[model samples]
Target: MNIQITPLTEDTIPGFHHVLEEIVREQKYLPITEAPPLDTLRTQLLEQLRHHLQHFVAMVDGVVVGWIDIKPKLSLPYRHVGTLGMGVLPAWRNQGLGQALVQLALKAAAELGLNRIELQVFEDNAPAIAFYQKLGFEIEGKFRRHARVGEQYRDALGMARLLEIAH
Candidate 1:
């Protein structure tokens, strides 16, 4: 299989949305209603791609299979830090796409001068936690009962990777 990672563009918004929706639905996660409309997302992505963040879409055989996003911390003291988020379509999971997306995001963060990268994974998501661990991220902290998934509160584990350290 040929997997290609490319910077996201306005024309790729629909493809991005398709992969995002598939992942969310497969994971039983809520749709991103709080995000702006599709046009807004496209514009925001373009702006971020140009300035503050890096968004990459993974394509296989000309179809979007996953996406990854990395953004610098918004707060003043944490400006050197970046956060990452990613998802792969269910049909594409366990095929190394997630790992590739994360590595790409980390590389982009380093190129953007970020020293630290962090992410939050639900405590129950063992596979994700393991994946992050394998990529040199350490569990730095946890928020007990912090996230409400559906009607129940769930703990979230904070993971971090210091770019200064060799993987």
Candidate 2:
């Protein structure tokens, strides 16, 4: 399969949304069970682009299969920090697409002067936790019963990596 990783663009938004909806429907990876309305998502994506956030999508034969995005923390004191989010279609997992997507986001984060990157994962998701650990992220803390899906409450682990940014 010919895989292409590129910055998220208007043209790729629909594919990106489709991939997200698929993942969300699984109800095992992300906290949300459904994607936001398409128009709402479009507005949010445009705002992220306006802010120059580091966001990327993985495409196979012109179809988006995964995405990664790192948005800067809002407070002035946390300006050098970014929070990351990502997902890959089940069929595309374990094929290095996730690693490639994250590496690109991290490089862009460093280029933008971000000194730290953070992410939160459901504590029950061992594979995802291991993936982040392999990428140099450390388990910083855990939030008990952090997310409630229907009648179930899940714990979440906060992970972070400090980047050595060169002046």
- List candidate 2 stretches off by more than 4 Å: none
Model 1: how far residue 21 lies from native, Å: 1.3
Summarize candidate 1's per-residue lDDT along 18-104 as a digit string, tens digits: 877666655433324243567777777877777678789999988888888988977889888988888888788898888888888
TM-score top scorer: 2
TM-score of 1: 0.88
Structure candidate 1, residue pairs in collision: none
Query: For model 1, what is the C-alpha lDDT against the true structure?
Result: 0.81
lDDT of 2 by residue, 63-138 (tens): 9999999999878999999999999999999989999998999999999999899999999999999999999999
lDDT of 1 at 16: 91
Per-candidate clashes, comma-separated: 0, 0
* Residue pairs clashing, model 2: none
The reply for model 1, stretches above 4 Å from the true place, is 27-36, 165-167
Lowest lDDT 10-residue stretch of candidate 2: 46-55
